[model samples]
Target chain A: TQLLEQSPQFLSIQEGENLTVYCNSSSVFSSLQWYRQEPGEGPVLLVTVVTGGEVKKLKRLTFQFGDARKDSSLHITAAQPGDTGLYLCAGVSGSGYALNFGKGTSLLVTP
Target chain B: NAGVTQTPKFRILKIGQSMTLQCAQDMNHNYMYWYRQDPGMGLKLIYYSVGAGITDKGEVPNGYNVSRSTTEDFPLRLELAAPSQTSVYFCASSYSEGREQYFGPGTRLTVT
Candidate 1:
């Protein structure tokens, strides 16, 4: 029973294509964070959204926090092969000490 | 600033063997954590420390032990390793609990 669920467990796209990954949960969160992990490496923080309905952008990547603070989404524009990696979303819950992570979405971008 | 550093980037352990995974952070973060990542699964927290001498179990604490004697070091110990323990282990540090965590390169453990 994953507290947070990510959709499209796997994604493969061509260069310059656009993709969006969704993370949903029933419980409200104080904040949501997005991370990217590459093979043989640990996950790196991409962005953190704290307010409901807030949108943050990092380069070609955009992160949005749901109005209810129960979900979040990450969108990548004009994907490139270098963008291939596993994306993960984590929710900050209960006084902000622990993080509950989603199953993660594996992305592969081929040129 | 080295951020977080974990030792033994790769290790192979035989069943029933025991070993310790070393983690050190240079940022002087007060909060430290241990997490394991399995294939196709999100990181599962094993243990965490709020400060020196204050340790707590997270979602997955079984088969693992941790001690935080200093602010910069948090080591994870695995006793009688099992095949199920084989996964990539990551150590993270943060200025505060529930804040953005900085991760190490990760240690890959394979148990046979």
Candidate 2:
């Protein structure tokens, strides 16, 4: 069963354009995380949100965890060519350390 | 320090063959995990270990096994390769639950 669902499986935009991607789930999570994966590379941790309704910023990227703890969103301001990659969202529930990952949103920022 | 490292960046095996995927981390983390990513399918956990000598199954563990005999090494074994097992495998480690995990480059495996 897929616990998490990400929207806009693929996106293409001009550099400097703003965009937002979403991750949603029916089950609440103790913590949520975002990862960025480049071609032929592993997914790298971008941020982790533990509190419901929490928000974090990584330079131009803004991430928010829903108050219900069942959903999250990532907004990129002025997307750049370097930001082209696969963005994934994962959630941790129960007592286990394993992560339930979403199918991911693939973004392509063109010059 | 090398956060996490995997061997044989890419591999191809014949059906019914066997192979081990190696993973090592120098951060001395207590938690390690193995995950497989299929095209457009993010990642699915195969196994995990909280510490050396302790291991557990994750969301998907069919036809796969893992062992963590040391803090720095966690190896995943496929007893019999299958076309269904073809995917990109990644190894990650973290200090503990809810912490940022460091991932290795990944092993792209194809079983024909």
Candidate 3:
């Protein structure tokens, strides 16, 4: 079973649209990370949230860490084709040496 | 720096064959990890290392072996390959457990 669960396994939106993807888990995490991956490439880090209720904005993307640290969300505003890729959420392992990744939300922003 | 480098970008192995997937990091990170991803799926941790001469298994350790002889290299060995082992392998390095990770492009292995 996946340590983390992501909603909307797949999403397809038009340009200039807005969308949000959620990642939830029963286990609490010290920190959570978001990554974007393209075809034939490894996932690339986007943002990291540590504090409860903390929100971080990266240009058009916004990340929010849950108050209980067991969930997180990624919001994309004015989505563009460049935003099309697989978005993955990973929670740091208890030992602080490994990552527990979510199944990922595949987003397609078509023009 | 070559954050994380994995060699043999693509390989096809017949069933029962043996091969090793190589991983190296130049960022001087102390933690390295090996993960396998099947088609249309997320990465599954196979093995990981914290330092030279130290190693541990991850969630899916079966059918895989790893040795950390040096801080820069962590290789994944598949003995008696099977079709079920076909997947894309990725190597990642991080300064610490909760820190951001740097990942290699990947190694696509097909065990026929």
lDDT of each: 0.93, 0.94, 0.92
Worst 10 residues of 3 chain A by lDDT: A92-101
Q: Residue B6 in model 3: shift from native, Å?
A: 0.9
Give one digit per residue, the lDDT tens place, for model 1 in B56-106.
Answer: 999999999999999999999999999999999999988997789999999
Stretches off by above 4 angstroms in model 1 are none
Residue-level lDDT tens digits of model 3 in B33-92: 999988657889999988899999898999999999888999999999999999999999
TM-score for each candidate, following the candidate numbering: 0.98, 0.97, 0.97
Q: What is the interface RMSD of candidate 1, in Å?
A: 1.6
Q: Candidate 2, clashing residue pairs?
A: none
| Clashes found in each candidate (C-alpha, N, C closer than 3 A) | 0, 0, 1
The digit string of per-residue lDDT tens for model 2 on A5-24 reads 99999999999999999999
Across B1-111, the per-residue lDDT of candidate 2 in tens digits comes to 978999999999999999999999999899999999999888999999999999999888999999989999999999989999999999999999867888999999999
Worst 10 residues of 2 chain B by lDDT: B94-103
> What is candidate 2's CA lDDT for residue B10?
94
**Candidate 1 positional error at B44, Å:** 0.3
Model 2 misses residue B105 by how many Å?
Answer: 0.3
- Candidates ranked by DockQ: 2, 1, 3
